[model samples]
Target chain A: MTSFFIYKAILVVVVFGIMLMAAMYSTYLERKVAAFIQDRVGPNRAGPFGILQPLADGIKMFMKEEIIPEVANKTLFIVGPCIAMLTAIMAGVVIPWGGELVINGVPYVLQIIDFDFGLLYVFGVVSLGVYGIMIGGWASNNKFSLFGAIRASAQMISYEIAMGLSIIALIMMTGTLSLREIVEFQAGGTGSTWNFWNVVYQPLGFLLFLVCAFAECNRTPFDLPESETELVGGYHTEYSSMKLGFYLFAEYINMFISSAVISTLYFGGTNFPFMNDLGLSQNAITILGTLAFFIKIGFFVFFYMWIRWTLPRFRYDQLMYLGWRVLIPLAIANVAITGLVMILTDRI
Target chain B: MKSLTGRAKVLDNPKMTFKERIYLPAIIGGITITLRHLFKRKATIRYPEEKRTFSPVWRGMHVLKRDDNGAERCTACGLCAVACPAEAITMTAAERKPGEEKLYREEKYAATYEINMLRCIFCGLCEEACPKEAIFLTDRLVSTDYARDGFIYGKDKLVEPVDKRVDVSKRQTPNVLEFKKIKHYRHNR
Candidate 1:
């Protein structure tokens, strides 16, 4: 029991370290993508094609002076970014990175904790992500910050409905809220055909989920909360130093979490096609599966950056209209269609 | 009012077509364009490491010329200073001393000459007005400095070095050489 606990502790530390490193590099990739789209050479100075740029950026962020507004709420002001960073990292807990790891003939499931309602827990934690922005904006005592906070909360609340409804259709198809179970159901056991990825069953649901994921993460087209042209620096207008860094870092972490979740749900997490036929050992298969999962996750992250550079920010009214009128109705219709199809097929 | 050129499209905001309303096709088009750019050669010329070649007629910084024998060509005739629109050129004329014929090609030479680069427009008017063919603008850019005093370029900066050569021949076109030839013929006559 003590050894198992120690393993879990080690896993937590490793996962945290990976998450932080991925988030740091995402900033560098974002700049490179932006430069490429504009036909310019991006950062290639700091340590060979700017690979060590994130280290330089971290040092700069740490070395900067921290500032707090005189009229700001001192306690919540500091708590805001901490909460943001905490909630962002918390969303990764129930996500399974691989199938299993066997050590000394004892098989251990490669997840932090396989909760019964893993999807619900993720959704709940992600929705709470808005509170950080809200508290930060309100505590700043600046109008722009307040406006940004309000916009973020409103947008998050509106999109959360569509996101939940989209997931509901998937739940009806899989009949399980545990993410690992969903993956297993789709994988169809070791040597089966790779025809059961959820995206084939839920295309419209995936689209709705994707759009809502963008809004939930406060990415472009839904990034009104911190739209530079309209709101200056928005919620972090008054924040400086590591506090600001924490807020920005939390955003990238949220992006990574959403990518992982999307890959898990639709792309069949850690289930590479024809893996069992390769005559590999259990440990090798497990390692390959983990690599495949990361590949899927990396593709989604690249897609996020691509869409961000391609699309322009939507107007406030258009944003709200899309979330409430368009996405919510489409998500509902998707759920209904899924149910009807399931019933007609006698699969229920 | 009627359109002047008959090329104006309607000003009314048209309703989006069904495909346009979905916006996916347009977004895909944009993504493809950016993806194309990602593979295209970047336009950024990394400065300091690489420099662009200047055009033949491009005038940059001033250089007081020397004849093939390395004698100063200026006679301090003040024509270039008179023609300078910015009043940037100033010189003091001195009679050629007894043993200084090897240094000065003319009986008179500019003893002290300066050009305030801060005021000079690099228009090549001084180059055009130099009767002795003393001053010409090369394709060399003036290096920036912190102090205004450093901008007043003296003879040490403007004159070509004795050992190292400065080529202002690119700025002297065929017409300019022809004019110089004609002037030399007139001086001989």
Candidate 2:
């Protein structure tokens, strides 16, 4: 058990390193996408096709002068992004990359650990994620920053309820809270019994889930917190250098993990059709599963960037109204329909 | 007045039906419309890799002019300075030196002329006011600097080199405010 913990710890470190690189590149991708949309030249220097742009940015950020506000809460300001980044990284542990691998006659799950309440675990981590933005904004002592933090806290907390409800509806259908069991439920080896993926059963639930995911993740149309026009850098207004970098990096990490969750939950979670009968080797099958999972996640990540450049952000009141009056009620109704259908079909 | 105290402030409300109350249909519809745009070969010029034609009319960095003989056309006539609305122009008239006839067309040529570009509004009134056709606004626009001092253009900065030429025939700059529709302001009487 101790050895397994060590391995999981190492895996966490490795995943975090990769996530760091990914978050930096997301910034690059964001800039490139923005430039292309607006018909302007983005960063194309520093390295070949600006592939080294992230590295340059990392170095620059590290070298930058740290600016602190005179009247701000010093310790909390520093801790805010740390909390955000930690929460973002923690969410990934519950997401099973592939079911498990048997090595040297020992079985080990692809996830860090098989938590029984993986869905709840994801929700719990995501809920805590808002505190980073809240503390950052409040600690900055700027009114604009405070306003942004308030928006973030309200927006995230509101959407999270709808998000949780949508997950509950999924749990009702899948009948499993564990990510591994959810993956297995979709895998068609149960005698041609898997009629369709969970999506077919819960299209409305999936839609609600994904939209709420976007709001919880706080992408555009929901990005009222960091609305550049109004907030002037938002929660990170008084932060500079590596502290600011942490806040920005936390956002992309959240985007990445949410994309992974959306992929795992809706799009069959590493389960592919007819790959088993194709007579492929076990290692090959595992690799294939990993590839499919990444393809789904990568597409969503790209979509997230694509939408940011395309849409204007929602107003604060409008966002609140949408969450409270629209999404929450819609989610409750979806739960009702899901429950009613399950009962009438005698599947309950 | 005593009876009116029982009444509360009224608020306007819109009635929503079953479908509207259950807004998944509309929200899904909104997502679908956006998804079409999300995939529609994004309407953008991937710039640097793909340079969009910045209209030849685009006002960018300005360049001064040299006459065809490479001699300055100004005869030290200070009409441009006087006509400038922004008070940008400044010059010192120097007497024509012997054997420098080909260099300057006038006996009284400007020895030192400087435009505090920070003050120059790029209005082209100075260009219109130049009787000698020396001071003119080029197709180029004003360049920018972080410091206030960088905006001041001396005679050395404003005068074009001998190799370069500005077409004497082409019209000077046009008024930007006049062309901008809807955002234009009308003088209140």
- Top DockQ hit: 1
lDDT of 2 by residue, A74-131 (tens): 9998899899989998898888787556667666666776789998898899899999
Q: lDDT: which candidate is best? A: 1
lDDT for each residue of candidate 1 in A1-348, tens digit (9 for 90 to 100): 998999899889888998999999999998898898889988888998989999999999999999999999999999999999999999989999888899998888789989999999999999989999999999999999999999999999999999999999999999999999988877734444555689989999999999999999999988999998999988999999999999999999999999999999998888888776778898998899989899998888888888898899999999999999999999999999999999999999
Q: Which ten contiguous residues of candidate 1 chain B have the minimum total lDDT?
A: B180-189
Give fnat of each prediction, in order. Answer: 0.76, 0.03
Q: Which one wins on TM-score? A: 1
Model 2 segments more than 4 A misplaced: A1-10, A32-53, A64-77, A99-109, A130-160, A188-195, A219-238, A305-333, A343-348, B1-73, B77-98, B105-108, B115-137, B140-189
User: Which stretches of model 1 miss by more than 4 angstroms?
Assistant: A188-194, B1-9, B184-189
Alpha-carbon deviation at A137 in model 1, angstroms: 0.9
Place model 1 in a CAPRI quality band: medium
Task: Report how far off residue B166 is in candidate 2 (Å).
Answer: 4.8
Question: Residue B60 CA error for candidate 2 (Å)?
Answer: 8.8
Instruction: Report, for every candidate in turn, its global Cα lDDT versus the true structure.
Output: 0.91, 0.78
